[model samples]
Target: MFEYTIIDKSLENKIILITGAGAGIGKEAAITYAKLGATVILLGKTVSKLEAVYDEIIALGLAEPAIIPLDLKGATKQNYIDMSATIASQFGRLDGALLNASILGELTPFTQIHEQIFNDVMKVNVNAQYLLAQALIPTLQLAPNASLIFTSSGVGNQGRAYWGAYSISKFATEGMMQVIADEYENSTLRTNAINPGATNTGMRTSAYPAEDKDKLATATDIMPLYVYLMSDDSIAVNGKTIKAQ
Candidate 1:
């Protein structure tokens, strides 16, 4: 669908929730979605960064954005429930969500990984996604149609050496996407996983400190995949893992 999918004003008046909206791909997605006419809800751990994105959106004269400062590692089920409730009360419906927030943790051998790091990665990547998705299901159902995207990774498809808990968490994410897609197969919700490969982001720099940044794509470069998934073009594309390189 990436090759021939046409971009249009399909997201006008839609409500989208994006985690990790503070920087990198999440920030770009928030701005792009807002420019395309979606009312973006920016959720991230950094209050200052989310506010910056919010200010940018407002300055662009795009649809106004909402902000939620949430630390996924410490997020409880009640946090998701409260978020869902707030979105319901404020927007009346949720049209899309991008589960893009994650941590790199310790990129060490499994035996060399600390227990806390592993737990933190799992909590942010896997558990938080489950809780958020579960809480937002009803809100999504209220929409005429909705898109839900889970961020995946190359290590998720085939575990890499020294990737440790981060890779495991992404694999679990792919599983979660598949399970949710299957459950909503006959419904109006579409769920899928996207691997945003080799992006020039802080996380990528941390993962590959020696690599030449110029050789990699920026967050804006892979945004077509994000937009296509959230737009009506990929409404029937579900339960699949896609690459955005």
Candidate 2:
């Protein structure tokens, strides 16, 4: 596990947006952020799942979380721009954004990769992230300090056999993070990427169905690094990919 002290209410009065907030790591992060006193904006494709998370946060007496039911695969650049505009209009500024939403395209031989699957994966994991980051950078700049976190994978830095478009998309994600970080290096907005190594999520299960999930770390177990990167403590850390295991 990444070693970082979890502080109480470290994110107080912050406005944070999290993609894939409907389930898995994204859902856990949303609730955790709310517990730390952040007004979390939950963005996901499933309205019911987002609502369930919202209800759970409200029941815990945490900060009230807003939900944006959006499918990245179908959403356009203007959609992302409008979403950011709405968030800005309501919250005044965004303190953090976790771009965690992604699709794991079928794992197959490099030569056997399907065209449609590759396109779909790139659409969600690459293009959508590009659009979202472009739209959110302005809002993030509004804060005294802001964190922009992109989700990456082990295969992103080191290629693995049969990972296909999923791996390629993550490579693009890392590249995007670096480009954005470099551009905003001297600004209040700091950009970084997190490689949540081998967490037991639905996407992991789909990619490795026969693996022993009991032996794998849960999403909650890896949140220390997530919280650390989003907090003011990490204001000096930028343009790097850190592992959470």
Candidate 3:
């Protein structure tokens, strides 16, 4: 499992938001961040799952978490704008945000790809992210220092056979991160992407069923990088593609 030898309360009092916070990498990141002293706003399609994570954080005596049940596949610009406004009202400012929610549509040959699947994947993986970022920029700017982390994939940087729309969306994600990073180059906000290579998550299991799950790193393992990117420790690092393994 991935481990972080260093632990600090540097994130104390930080207001952080994590999409896809109900499961896998997103869940682990939310738990870790809360433990390290950030008040996490958990966003996921499943209210039950989000509540579960919230309860776990409360159980640990960490910062209390808020739950937002939202499905990115069907979210609109107005939805993101409303969410941003809500966060601003509740937290005053957003210290960081993790764009971790994504959909992996059917993996098939380019000629065999279905339009519905492609559009669905793009809506969740690309469009929603863009809208969320656009909506949250004002909230992020209110903070003294803020970070935005986008979840990316290896296939994004290098095209692979049969990776389908998921890969394409990740590429757009990386590009989006770079564009935002560049735009906020002299500002308090920073953006970056992380490729959590071959972790033992449901998504990895679906992508590589033949692989030995026991050999893969757990979602917790890659959290150090996640925490680092979100916290002040990595304020100087931006617009870079980092691998968490």
Candidate 4:
């Protein structure tokens, strides 16, 4: 199963929304889904970056993508609701959502944790996810089968001393996934979390500047697990925290 290949049309006719779709794993997932024949809705804070991903999908003669410029840190519940309403109007149903947007607060000691940084991290990593999931539930229910994925971290499962707010936020993320998964266990909607471990991304660099980049897997290399989660192949997989590579 690990060696299985994701085919070109694996996601044909699917409609997927990806938060933080401007770069890193989110960007790659958006592109990969588009290539697999899914209509992708790219959401991020940067218009230029989202446009670049949009153009790339268009240029490939793949599904035309849509862009929603949003900063998760500042987004309100109403904003997510409005976005969901718009998606419902445009596509009728949402097939998948990859909640990949997260904020890594300063890695500091427990006693020295800054208040502002802690609030900011929780707002983006936890609050935003809660609002987004709440807003999109209806649209997701409209689909025949919907997949909701949360971006999790290793520190979330087993707390690390210096990981601080980022780790706490991810633990909350894992909790959110399990709660939603249990609630919708009998429905078509499935919720799960993925820990993209040791990926060569900006987040990793920020978290471990002294670490060797060559030792980590690239964002593109982790797409198989992501693709599997989003595709119908993993319909029975829900509420579990899966690691990428």
Q: Which stretches of candidate 4 lie over 4 Å from their true place?
A: 1-3
Best model number under TM-score: 2
Pairwise TM-score winner, candidates 1 and 2: 2
**Model 1 CA RMSD to the hidden true structure, in angstroms:** 1.2
In the predicted model 1, the residue pairs found to clash are none
lDDT value for model 3: 0.91
Model 4 lDDT on a 0 to 1 scale: 0.94
Clashing pairs in 4: none
- 1 or 4, which is superior by TM-score? 4
Q: Which parts of model 3 are misplaced by more than 4 Å?
A: 1-5
lDDT (10s digit) by residue, model 1, range 66-134? 999999988899999999999999999999999999999978987899999999999999999999999
| Per-residue lDDT of candidate 4, residues 113-206 (tens digit) | 9999999999999999999999999999999999999999999899999899999999999999999999999999999999998898898899
What is the lDDT of every predicted structure here?
A: 0.92, 0.96, 0.91, 0.94
lDDT by residue (tens digit), candidate 2, 11-123: 99999999999999999999999999999999999999999999999999988899999999999999999999999999999999999999999999999999999999999
Position 80, candidate 1: lDDT: 95
Mark the regions of model 2 whose C-alpha exceeds 4 Å error after superposition.
Answer: none
Better of 3 and 4 by lDDT: 4
The whole-model C-alpha lDDT of candidate 1 against the native structure comes to: 0.92
User: Candidate 2's error at 214, in angstroms?
Assistant: 0.8
Query: Order of candidates by TM-score, top first?
Result: 2, 4, 1, 3
- lDDT tens string, model 3, 1-245? 23546477868999999999999999999998898889999999999999999999999999889999999988889999999999999989999999999988888999999999999999999999999999999999999999989999989899999997999999999999999999999999999999999899888888787999998989987888898888787899989999987
